[model samples]
Target: MGRRTPSAYEGKGYLQVKASNGKCLTVPYDNGPAPPAGTQLFWWDCETRWFCASQLWNVVPVQVGTADANRTAYRFVNHWTGLRLSLGPATAGESGGRVTQDTCPK
Candidate 1:
């Protein structure tokens, strides 16, 4: 099992995913309507932007395989709505669709 460095945002209530180019994974405020579940998550080119509730995420640890107990990954759950992030069937094609939130699959 591999270990990762502790993030500065750890235990800060919200997890911010930043891209190599300095952009952040953001859920826009003006997402047409209220309730951010169906809103598409995208990268925003901003350094000092206020993160709204929709942009906040809860890290959910998920264990994979039985090889090592420490080997695990994470699922991002929206803070506003308790939905897990997923690539829907519509986005499975080569074209790829926007990242949306959905019910967690068992």
Candidate 2:
């Protein structure tokens, strides 16, 4: 028999931390809402442990809603890491859509 693949896999998520020092870090987005205020998000990259921009400051989501068919934004901060992050103005990017259809063999 051929090599069997692993049946289980681990899920991963990114954390964007903002620091009170006016620094912003971009990592990954999680399913949760956001972190609380006054906390630092610490992550060890290589041998250095750093936090994101949002994790530095205390930023919370003023309004949490859905985005359009295009994109969305948010204003949040890291509680554990004390990172700061924000959602600025909205701008459009390359626009286009493609629809794929499948046909069964006759």
**lDDT of every predicted structure (CA atoms):** 0.62, 0.31
Count of backbone clashes for each model? 0, 35
Q: Put down candidate 1 lDDT per residue, 1-106, tens digits, no spaces.
A: 1121125445754665666766656666565554445667777654344545565677888887776556778888766667777775666564657777777657
lDDT of 1 at 36: 48
The numbered model that scores best in TM-score is: 1
lDDT of 1: 0.62
TM-score computed on alpha carbons, candidate 1? 0.60
TM-score of each: 0.60, 0.19
What would the TM-score be for candidate 2 when compared with the true structure? 0.19
lDDT tens readout by residue for model 2, 17-94: 324543344323365544443222232221125433322323333433557444444433333333443222131232
For model 1, where is the 10-residue window of minimal lDDT? 1-10
